[model samples]
Target: MSNVLLLFDKMGQRDIVTWNTMITQLVKTGDVDLAYKMFVEMPERNVRSWTAMISGFVQCGKPKEAISLFTKMEETCLKPNEVTVVAILAACADSGFLDLGSKIHESSDNNGFTRNTHICNTLIDMYIKCGCLEAALDVFEGMKEQTVVTYSAMIQGLAIHGQGEKSLKLFFEMIQTGMKPNGITFIGLLNACSHMGLTNEGLGFFTTMTNDYEIVPAIEHYGCMVDLFSRAGLLHEAHDFIKEMPIKPNAAIWGALLGGCKVHKNIEMAEVAMRHLQELDPFNDGYYVVLANIYSEAKRWEDAARVRKLMKNRGLNKTRAWSSIAVKGMVHEFVAGDDSHSLSMEIFEKWNELLVQMRLKGYVPNTSVILLDVDEMEKEKFLSRHSEKLALAFGLINTRPGETIRIFKNLRVCEDCHASFKLISEIVGREIVVRDRNRFHCFKNGTCSCSDYW
Candidate 1:
């Protein structure tokens, strides 16, 4: 980025395109704060400039900032174009801001911009991301001319919601219309199958993707395959598949296999995955954490301790799990044992009440997943203060009883929390949707959408 800046200084005058390109690249590189610095220093702002910054903020996980930037852009003379609408819709999608997303759709209509395929597809994606599957279906049905991307978005939406069969049916419909599927389409299809444990169907789709469609498998495609096999406890097949891949497997591929190992408790395969992961990404704490967790799970105390010691020696620490909930356009963040909010006391009080209720509902903490060598009671205590639980407590305290509670978790929901949420959702008589790093878990009536599989 500094080299690009030096190149910029060499130019007598830089155009908006040059500035926008630099800003966009910086944002993509995870330097949004630096991108903002460049954005503010621009001589003049256009729709592109505002849109770039808004999109950058969203990509940086600052959806509220993106919306703020969009509002500021509206106050100016320039009307928001299709590109600007797509960026803001993405922000709305990431935050599950359905009401605000509707406003964006209406804004496009008011601006007299043509409802092109790109904008319409983005709308589909936004609705899906916000957990409004019916609304996404409505948008997909309303489109006049749909592209492969449109189908891909709809497929991904269904897949995430555990509607693998519906997504497959749609794939058939898409091909019947004589449109060839692309890499994105197959990724969505395979992911749908993977998440739903439709192993046979997923493998079938994988074969069809490469043999029939002639889409040379990308690393992402291989990752999905590994995930599908690994989640099914077929550790040997997944390992062999990784070895036989035409292209060399990367960290993501190994990570997917490792995740499966974690789920299936395959200590040997987890060790193999960790060895490759260490070579590929030496600084990533996740590999070490998972390897240690596998040892802890197996009651291999000395091995787990050694892994933790190695992590400390290498100056690597586990990433803190964080979660946030949006209520009435305001987002509240919570980390494990968090007490920083103004309603911290009230939140804990509500949490205590929840614990009593959870106990009455026969909730037993799953201590096997603690990953720490501690007493069972201490393990339970630590689990109670997890980020998702705190966020859920805060959501229950603030939101209406009948409203759906949506929380975003930065990591996979812990085993104990996942079990606890099942009871909490039934006891509270409200739908609770937790979007974790893996997939959306909609807890309703004492059951999770994952069906104890994930």
Candidate 2:
């Protein structure tokens, strides 16, 4: 990379291709900031240069910047080609920019990319990630041809959205089309079965995946199977399955079991899972947090304190949680107790008003999710200021009463927030769609699409 840079630097008459190559190479080498600098320093940029920079932003986890650059490109009236469209679409997906994503979908159609399978697949993914499952399905249904990638995205989308039965139906239909299910296909199948508690069916598919398809199980496949059994409340069986695995169980495999243990309130099994996790991934704060959460759930305050102390001793800090909501094509983000937004006062006031109404609707704050050793009132206050709740309040303040509120969270939704969201949705008479770390939670009329299962 240094040599290439040096050679490019020595070139006296660098053209657009040379500049684009250097920027693309820098992006490929994980120097997105440098690439952006070069992009800015360029005498002028063609579509390729803009595309490269946008793609770099997406790759480097700067989706908002990618969206910003794409907007600038649009202002220039330089039509994006397929590559630019795909790159920016990915940014839209990552940042939950559904409004921009929908616009791109229309642009793609006008630009004669509707039949482009790759773009269509990306469209499906963008819609799914944006918590628009029906839109994703619409894109899938409108496709003239579906690849394994397309099928995989749709299947996973359905599974995560709590449409396990429909996901399985799609898989069977895929089989009828003679497309041949791959490892990814089976993973999606296993996830569907896991989410819906189709234990025997999941096992059957696992067996068939190996014997009939000759696909060797990767760590992900093994992880999915463990998740299946663990989610099904078969902790002992999941343990035995891990023991019998041909390869060593990774942190994800053990973590899946721990997650199930938390869901089922199996402290003994949760400890067992933690013992392995400590060895496999001791530094991962998520594992320690989960164990602490389990102890808190069981009212083992001392044990929870001990786990937290252990984390402190190991110099581990809990991952900061945040949630985002997009309004008027601009994304607004909130952290726990965040007060930095311009509408902070309004957000707090709106939430206070909603809480009064929510309480009237029989909403009692479940303070258990807060592991802190504080008074119940303090704990409830802390819970009320959670990032997602702030985002929800902000959304309610900014949007019309009947408008749907969509949010994206960086971590799993807490039990307290999940329960409160159901009541809040009912009180507000609007659909609240939240895409969290685990899955989609669409709350409407006092029920979640996940059926409170996720």
Candidate 3:
């Protein structure tokens, strides 16, 4: 890389090709900042140059910046090709910029690019990630030709949205089309069974994937099996399954078991999983937090304090939770106890008003989810400021009455917030869709789509 850059710098003159080569190499090497600097220094940029920078931002997990760059490219009147659209759609999806994504879909239709299979697949994925399952289904049903990638993306989307049965049905449909399911396909199938608590069905699929399809079970497949057992409250079975695995377990495999332990409140199994995780992923703060929460739930205060001290000694801090909602083409973010927003006062006031009604509807804060050893009043107060609650309050104030409130959170929703959202959805007479680290929760008519299982 240094040699190529030195020769390029020594050149008498450089054209777009010479400049683009450096930019592409910089992006590939994960030097997006330096690539952007070179991009601005370029004598001129074509669609390729803009596309490279935009794609780099997506790869580096800077979706907001990628969307901004795509906008600038449009201002310069350089029409984006299919590659550019694909990259930008990914940015929109990550940021939950559904309004912008819908516009891009319209633009693609006008430009005759909807027929492109890659673009269609991206559209399906974008819609699904943006919490627009109906839109995703529209794209899937309209696709004249479908590939394994298309089916896999749709199946995984359905699974994550808590639509396990729909995903299972889709898998059967894919098989009927004579599409050979790959490793990715089976992962989605197994995940569907895991999410829906179909332990027997998951085991059958695992067997079929190994014996009938002849696809070697990867670590992901094994992890999903553990998740299946764990989610079904079969902690010992999940543990035994891990012990019997052919390959060595990674942090993800152990983490799956730990997640089950958290849900089932199996402190013993959680500690067993953590013993492995501490060696495999010592720097990850999430594992420590989960273990501490489990201890706190069981009133093992000393154990929970010990975990906190270990995290502090290791220079680890809990990941602050935040949630985001997109309204009027702009994304609004709120952190736990956030008050920096311009309308923070109004948002809190609206939540208070809703709280009165929610309480009347039998809403009670589940204070157990508050891991701190605070008094009851303090715990309830802290629960009200959770990131998702703040985002939901902001959404209620900003969006129309009948419009759905969609929130994306960095972590899993706690018991208190989940219960509140169900009541809030009914009180507001609108649907609320929350996408957390685990899966989607759709609340309407005082009920959740997951049926309170997840």
Candidate 4:
């Protein structure tokens, strides 16, 4: 490190590529702050230096900082190249700065970077990550030439947005274009089929990927297949599929099967899945939580209690759930009844109002998930203090009337919270889009797009 700093001191008339190499080395070594300092200290900065710094910021989880730097670069009369635009647009997408992303798109065209396939592919990925599927499709269609990367990005975007049919169509088009699909392409296609419950299609794709495309299924591909068969109520087939996997099933594969078992209320299969899950991840609270829920659903209180005791004996505890909302360009995260925020009083009052409105609208608290030894009223309090509701209330308080609210949760949307979001959407006359760990839930008028299947 000192030798590199000494080299920097002795540098004379270094060009853009020289500075870029230094910046890339620093960024790759996880010295983003130092890299930014070098970027500011450079006497003759170019597009490569700017792009390297911006990519560093994005990689280091400082997307907002990357945006600020990009804006500074623009103000300094430096024309951003295709690489710069792609890196900055990725920052915008990751930060959920949709308006800023749009500006970047416009700027790309204004600066003649829009025609670059690399930039266009990045744009497509950005729009998809921002949940603007229509905009993604628009960018895709507007492209003069599409490459394999383009197809993969669009298909991934569509699959993630729950547009499975569109994703499959594009996959076929990619094949028709005579572009060989890579491993990522197969993963996206299989995931689309899984999300849409296309079991036969997914199975065929899995086979074709191996036999026809010579692409061996990785653990992720097998995980998607497990999810597909499991979600389709083919418990036995799903179990057998896992057994037949070339690679040994990992926690994710078994976890997918366990989730499906919970959905289908298959105690036998759930137990089988749990055995594998426990062996793979004995300390994961998710396994204990899911097994407990299964026992609860089956009215096996003793079994549920035994699992809880096992968790306690192993010194394992449930993770505190949290939710976050982006409001006024700031993300506000909340835990269950967290009172540490500066505006806690106001947030609490708004939450009470929301509770009243939801109750009046026939919202009933789902107390079954609160497995603690508590009374009905206590369970009700726990349900009301859930992190999702708190974050939703915060969004409602900060945003203008009728504006949509988007919240992200770290875990699955509990049954009670799902119902609450539906009621909150109707009571406030606003749309609430909650992205849970597994899927997206768009609630409006007391109805969820997933129809409570998730």
Candidate 5:
């Protein structure tokens, strides 16, 4: 940090590019506060200066602030170029600011900026994150030229939307264009396969990614393979794949296996995954919760208790799940049982009514996921208060008929909630796209894109 400041001091007269570079370096080094200071102190600020600050804010988990800066930049004389457009689009995507993203898309589409492939790619990504898969496809198809990034983003967006076959077709099209699939491209391909439970196809892609493209697998690629095998109920092969990884397996690999263990009720392998997880990521409280949940699902009461006790001993606490839904340009956030929103009473009442309708439609709450040995009625009420349900209720009451409801969650949607969303979609006669931690689940007519496999 001091070296950066010292180098800046040595410059006789700093140009806009020099100031932008130093500020960008500061942001890259996790000195966002210092970068902001430099941004404020710069004598002449260009589009890059504003862009560096906006991207810095986005990368530092302040998407709203980044959007605010972009808004302020609009009043300036300097029009945003491709780099600036991409940076602001990222903020819009992360913030679930669909309206704002569209506005930026409109702005970029003018002034010949959309001709830049990076801007087009960012547009596709923004539409995807906003739960507008159709718009994402339009951007992908309308691009006059596509780079690996353009194809990679489209592939990943399709995979997340559970359009695995489409992603695979696009991957081949990308290859036919003579654009070699890089590690990210293969990650997208593997992810598409994993979500669809195509274990053999995933393996074939992994082999081709290495042997044909000569692209060495990174930890992310390895993690995708682990997820692929694990999601297919191939616990033994997933474990073996981790064992044979050229690089040492990270916590993600073990975490993927743990998730599989949860799905398959493989307590024995869950324990093995937990052992590595605790050693590699001791501070991560989520792993302990997963282990405890696995034990709880298996009816191993003592084991579940032991894991919770271990968490307590290690001074770890399970973080409450949080979720948010953006309606019309405003974001509504909720935690479990927090009735703090202005429309709290309305949301709760609507939730109660929806629960009744769900019950009438033969929707029974899957209480096994509760992990707490409570009465069935109590478990039902508790499950009803999950953040995803609250967001769903809000969307159901607020959105117009036949409009899609998109909810973003910080945690993985529980199985109980997953089932509820499937039914909820059918009951409301609306499509619901839930973007949880790992992937997107599009629920329509009582079925999910994941097919209840997740």
Candidate 6:
């Protein structure tokens, strides 16, 4: 490391390649801060130098800084190349800056970067991450030069956005185009089938993965299959699949089955999955929570309470749920009835107003999903104070008259919250999109795009 630094300092004249090599070395050695300092100190900067710095920042989990630097580079008359554009788009995607990503997409053609496959793939990924599946599809359709990477990007994007039919269509299209599907391609297809609950198709594809493509299923592939069968209420088949897995099942596999069991109220399977999960992850409270929910659904009050007691004894507490909304290019996060904000009183008042409107629209809270042993009124109050409601109230207060609100949650949106959002969408006469951990829920006119299936 010292030798490389000495060589870099001793160089009489530095070119773009020399600076790039030094920066790459520094980034590789985890000296991102020093590399960024050197980047600013350089008298002359080129596309490669800027790209290297941006990529380094992204690698170091500083995507916002990388994006800011990219903007600065553009302002300084340094015309971005294809590589630079791809790096910047990746930074935007990682940071969830959809508006900035759209601006980058508009500049691609004029900057002569549209023809590059890597840049196109990055653009597709950015649009997908921003929850703009239509834009992603448009970009995919316009790619005159499609490679395996391009096809995989489209497949993954479609799967992620819950457009399973379109994802499968593109899978067949890739085959017709004479491109062989790879491991990633199959993973995307399987995930799409899983999300769509296409059991037979998912099973057939899982078999084809090894028989036709000669590709061994990885743990993730198997996990998707487990999720597929378990989600379809085929608890026995899911159990057998996990038992017969080529690779030993991990916590993710058990977790998937446990989640399904909770949904189906399968106490037996939930117990089985929980046992394996406990062995795999002794300290994680997720398995315990799922088991408790299953017990609660089955009216096994003692068992449910026992699980909670075990969690407390093990010094494990439930993670505080949080939700976030993007407003004026800034993200605001809130916990359940969070009063720590400077405008807490205003937010609380707006929340009360929303509750009144929702109740007037005949919105009744579904308190069955709340596993806590609380009275009915307390449960209703707790449901109202959920993190999603807080974030939604914040969005309502901050956004203008006609703007749509988009929120993201770290966990599944509760049943009561989902109903409330439906009413909120109708009451405010605005479109609301909430991306939870599982899937996207677009609420408009008192209805969700998924028809409440999710």
Best by TM-score: 3
* lDDT of each residue in 187-210, candidate 2, tens digit only: 889998888889999999999998
lDDT of 5 at 334: 91
Model 1, runs deviating above 4 Å: 1-35, 42-44, 58-64, 75-78, 95-99, 112-114
**Per-candidate TM vs. native?**
0.91, 0.97, 0.99, 0.84, 0.94, 0.87
Count of clashes in candidate 2: 0
Model 3 gets an lDDT of: 0.93
Which stretches in model 2 have alpha-carbon errors above 4 Å? none
Better of 1 and 3 by TM-score: 3
Over all chains combined, what TM-score does candidate 1 have?
Answer: 0.91
Which residue runs does candidate 5 get wrong by more than 4 Å?
A: 3-22, 40-46, 75-78
Residues 112-205, candidate 3, lDDT per residue (tens digit)? 9999999999999999998998899999999999999999999999998888999999999999988899999999999889989999999999
In model 4, how large is the Cα lDDT of residue 280? 94
User: Ten consecutive residues with minimal summed lDDT in candidate 2?
Assistant: 365-374
Of models 3 and 4, which has the larger lDDT?
3
Lowest summed lDDT over 10 consecutive residues: which window, candidate 1? 106-115
Instruction: Point out the higher-scoring one by lDDT: 4 or 5.
Output: 5
Local accuracy by lDDT, each model: 0.87, 0.93, 0.93, 0.84, 0.89, 0.84
- Tell me how far the alpha carbon of residue 323 in candidate 3 is from the true structure, in angstroms, after superposition: 0.4
For model 4, give the 10-residue run with minimal summed lDDT.
445-454
RMSD, candidate 2, Å:
1.4
